[model samples]
Target: MWHTVVGAVGLVMGLLPHVLHHIGLLAGTAFVAGSGGTALFGALGLLASVPMLIRLYRRFGSWVAPAVGLLVFAAMFSLSAFVIGPAISGAEGDVTTPSPAPAVDHTDHPGH
Candidate 1:
């Protein structure tokens, strides 16, 4: 059973590199407005969940699988909200401080 779970994770991991590469390439090349941060974070979160998934599936039959996944995802997102919410507000606070822009030296050109 453990071997089967390990094998499945290995199979998924094998496919991950190709998929990740394509996702990154597509996002970088095509989507200038939206960065791939969400996808990257999601993939990382899913990868982290695999082992927990296997264990949950093993302990509880296929019926419980979906609920376990939902719970895990919920927990992950809750944590993300808790952590990311603060950083965002903190970043905004940082920009609130007035840092004056440096003077430009276009004096050499006789615009005056």
Candidate 2:
């Protein structure tokens, strides 16, 4: 019973981000645009998976532990992409690229 609930929660939690991204509310391109509430939603979705992770740990023991870690990492990445991606995109103009250095005229140097 609880397992089913956990599974349902996990499924919904995992799918919500994809749905938002597909709908264009979440950041799919720019990072900062989705860095607001959408990022929070994604983080909440990951936190909601803790119960399912516990269930998995009990069922599969140590073997599935790594998988759980990977899931957490994936969740963090998704949230970061949605949140940071747009902010970075918006800040692209603030980043200054290095200009090419001018050639020195060595012919006028005493050591030349």
Leading candidate by lDDT: 2
Q: Could you give candidate 2's per-residue lDDT for residues 1-112 as a string of tens digits?
A: 9778878877887676556556554354343233465567656855775665676788778746858666777877775665575575565433578999998888987976
Give the TM-scores of the predictions, in the order they appear. 0.38, 0.37
How many backbone collisions does model 1 have? 0
**Each model's number of backbone clashes?**
0, 6
lDDT of 1 by residue, 1-112 (tens): 9789777876775576345556676664343212254455456657667677877778886748857696878687656544674475454332366789999988798866
Q: List the residue pairs that clash in candidate 1.
A: none
Please give the lDDT score at residue 104 for candidate 2.
84
Q: Report the lDDT of model 1 for residue 58.
A: 81
**lDDT at residue 100 of model 1 (Cα atoms):** 94
